[model samples]
Structure formats: structure tokens, C-alpha cells
Target: MSPASSDAQWYEAKVPPPLLGLAGLFLQHRLAPAGGGSWPRRAAGLGLSGGAVALMGSAAGTFRRRGTTVDPLHPDRAEQLVTDGPFARTRNPMYLGMAAVLAAHAVARGGVLTWLPVAGFVAAIDRIQVPPEERALHRVFGQDYADYTRTVRRWV
Candidate 1:
């Protein structure tokens, strides 16, 4: 199998995004010490959490309207290449939203150490989850996908 296909199979076989985020949260809880300096403000955390919710919701809604699958593990199942809504801002709005949520939670919990898991979550999505989906999109959509990638940032 090609590397993209292998990655797609691997991602499909592994735990879903929400579960991965939860695992990262669990890790943060265990790894971070009880007390530390707070780098993010409470208002900022709340704002980020709200923005995450909005972004994810908008992206999902757009997918539904466009009749495309939102599940990244099943990129082959996508029927359309949605570029409007939250997608216009970021190629992987769902993952970006998830990262935002993670960051918000870490900030709300109040510890610089908590940011470690947020970073890990972002890295995992960027390195692991996104590649296969990108490949699938390219295979399915060709130059259209490439154009979309060029115009939109992966994460914003």
C-alpha cells in the first residue's frame, strides 16, 4: 500500500479524535504537578472554548449541508469538497477546533504544564491524522484539492 493508504488504514483502525483528546487530557492531569504559574487568562480560555464550539459546529453544519462525511478516518466517504464556512479559514477546521478546545480546557484548569497535552494533541493531528485525509482528498479530488490547500491554511 502507498504511505497515504497505510496512514488511512492506521488512522481508521485507531481511536477517534475525541478519544485522543480525552487521552491527552488524562495525560495532562497525570503529568502536570498540582501547582504552577498560569499563562492563559480565564476570559481567554472561555473565549477560545466558545470559538472552538462555534468553529466545529459551523464546519459540521457545512459538511451536513454539502452532504459530505465529517469523519476524517473515512475521507473516502466524502461526497463534496466544502470550502465555504469554517473551511475557508482552515483546511482542517475540526482538528483546529479540537485543538482550541484542548487549549481552552488546559487554560481553564490553570497550569503552564497543561499546555503540554494541547501541544501533543495538535502535533498528533498535524502529523498523524491530517496526512491520510489529505492524500484521500487528493486522490478523490485531484487539482481541486490542491487548490483548496493552497488557498486555505491547514489550521488557523
Candidate 2:
């Protein structure tokens, strides 16, 4: 295999974004006990969780409809530059969805301490997972990806 391919494989084997969120949630549960909160806060958390699920499902469905890979680990396999549906809003909708879910989970847990995991999850995605995928997208889609990046937020 080529060096680039090997590197891609290595990155793919690294910690996944969802695992990071799970780790954060585990830490939150261990270090911070859930506290009491108002009903509005819980309702907001549920709303955020629902929105995250919808966004992820929409993005995945778009990928399926476009005949493209939804696997984040294999962005190099993307056959098309999807710029519609959830992609129109965020360049990384799935990652954003994961972050949103983490945030919602934290909120629902009813402790400010839960946010530590949310922050860690976001940090991992922003620092570790996203840059490689962005690079891969740019390599695959070139100027079109650049234009899309110019218009869409990474996470929104």
C-alpha cells in the first residue's frame, strides 16, 4: 500500500469520535453526580438530543441517496461532494451531531460537571478527527470543497 493509504488506515484505527463522547460520559458519571434541575432544562436537553439525531439521520440519508460513503473513517472513499441537506449547514454534520448529543446528554444529566466530557469530546473531534477528514475532503474535492468550507460552518 502507498504511504498515504497507510496513514489513512492508521488514522482510521485511532480513537473514534463517538468513543470519545462515551468516555466523557463515563467520566461525568464517575466524577460528577447528576443533580436536580428545572423541567425546562431537561426539555431543552431532550430537544437538543432529538435535533442531533435528526441531523445525523438526514446527513446519513443524503450520503446514501447520493451513493456516497457515510463512514467517517473512510472519507477518502467519498465519491461525491455532498453540499445539500444537512451538509448545506455544516461541513461536518455528523461530528456536529455527535457533539450535540454529548451536550444534550450532559445537560440531561443535570450537572455542570457533565460538561467536562462534552468539552473533551468537542476537543477530540476538532483536534484529532476533523483535521484529517477536512484534509481528505480538500484532496478529493479540491476547489469545490474549499468553496463549501467558505460557505458552511464546521459545526453549527
TM-score winner: 2
- How does each model score on TM-score? 0.87, 0.88
Residues 1-156, candidate 2, lDDT per residue (tens digit)?
Answer: 975687598676887666777787678677556454468877988999999999989999999999999877878889999999999988888888888887887777677777887888888889888888888888889999999999999987
Candidate 2 lowest-lDDT run of ten: 29-38
Q: Which residue pairs in model 1 clash with each other?
A: none
Q: What is the C-alpha local distance difference test score of each model?
A: 0.84, 0.83
Model 1: weakest 10-residue lDDT segment is 32-41
- Cα displacement (angstroms), candidate 2, residue 124, comes to 0.7
Candidate 2 lDDT score relative to the true structure: 0.83
lDDT of 2 at 137: 81
